[model samples]
Target: MTIISLQHVTKDYGHGRGIFDVSFHVKKGTVYGFLGPNGAGKTTAIRHIMGFSKPQQGIVTVSGLNSWNNASTIQETLGYLPGEVALPEHLTGEQFIQMMMDLRKIKDDTHCKKLMDFFELDASGKVKRMSLGMKRKLAIVTAFMHDPDILVLDEPTSGLDPIMQQRFIDFIKDEKRRGKTILLSSHIFTEVDATCDEISIIKEGHIISSFNKQELLNMTEKVFHLTVENTKDYTQLIQMIESDITFQLISKNEQINELQISCYPSDLSKLIKRIADFPLLSFSEVPFSLEKHFMEFYDRRVGGELPWQ
Candidate 1:
């Protein structure tokens, strides 16, 4: 089921810099990553979906309802954790949870204690006395306890400790198993790589790429690092190899030359066969890394910008 859709959804400040004609869809029971760098219009797009701000152009729909027209109803079914959380200093953890449930008119507190115990949060502690991580944990528990169908989280795990982060991952997995939809906005690629089924990357307020996680992973090329024992520079090795195989000599020492090469699927056999010529002291085909893939995308975006614009 298509749980959420944004069609040409645009929001901008005075400078005409925000999400420009952005469109995407989120399916039910899947996790989607909304990826971008700072000032890439991620927060603006999120605000429009949450109905905190109205879009100047285009539409955002959740469960077939206009995000702004039926904001309250949409919110009832949405669990949101904002990038920046501000809790009143005077309110205790327990009080805050009660206030949240009151606004939704939910009388049952069944999940409150359970969530607190799960996160090891102190419900009796005042907001002012709690650490940043503790406050974040409290917000996370509060957002999830209501059993919402759609979760919209912005930078959800920024301040969390490693243990809490692992637990959060477990929580998202459990939510997905129960057929909940999640939209996660994150700069942390590793977390997104681990949690998201589909990912859309935005750069300078534009959608650069959108694809399924497994597909992207498969497209990432494996890098082969070779250090030849024989005395040969990168130029000599390039001359010896066939032209179809793409290779780059990264560095060279007195006795060995280091090369970073990529082999296309069709050329994998040819590439392995050609390596027999060089005295291979160290030859390792490194697995593709999500971090490297993310950097490559970012570099392309940065380098492709027009000079005048």
Candidate 2:
């Protein structure tokens, strides 16, 4: 079931500064990724879903209830972690957790303790003295303490180091397995790929692409990086790709006579045969990457087939 839906949502801030004609849905017990960079309207669309801002042209709903009209109830029940975490500097982390618990009327501290421990957060320190990563962990702990059925996390690991980022990624996976519905918005490609059941790439206030995890996997393309023995082979290789559609030129380094090409699994044998006789310095297949597909969408013109597609 769709737990959240936005139909033809348009929130135009003058000069193309807001989401426009945005529409997507998040099913129950799935992670939906809103992938984009800063100023890509990711935050804008998220704000609308959370009912923090009303859509001027469409409806935003959570569990079939109009988000704007039932804003309080929706926000109260959903665990939300904003991209920029703001906390009271005067309070210790423990004190802030207590305050949140009191405000939400949560009598159970058991879940909160587990979250703090899982994140290795030391809540005795004052917020003012906390490092950026520490502050981020504190925010994560509080957002998840209630163990809400649904969560909306925006750049949830913004200030975390690599270790903490991986921890957050693992945490997301654990939550997914528990059947929690999650909306994860982040520009980091790996986290989104690792956790999301569905992905929507939003760029310049518009959702340019959307696909499920299986679809993305089904469309995966293998990239091969190889260096030829000399310019003769390199020129011939480039010409070969230009003539046929089987091999796709991804990149080239003329000075070193090296180049990268993408080959669909169905055509890998054909590519190998076509270049088997060429004098080569080295050849290797690069692992599949979602970033490649994402950048193609970001850079391609208004109507062009995606490289992976």
- Full-model lDDT for every candidate: 0.81, 0.89
List the pairs of residues colliding in candidate 2.
none
Candidate 2 wrong stretches, greater than 4 Å: 225-245, 248-261, 268-283, 301-309
What does candidate 2's lDDT look like per residue over 208-232, in tens digits?
A: 8888877776667778999999899
Per-structure clash totals for the candidates = 0, 0
RMSD of each: 3.8, 3.3
Task: Give TM per candidate.
Answer: 0.85, 0.84
**Which window of ten consecutive residues has the lowest lDDT sum in model 1?**
300-309
Candidate 2: residue 291 Cα off by (Å): 1.7
| Candidate 1 global TM-score | 0.85
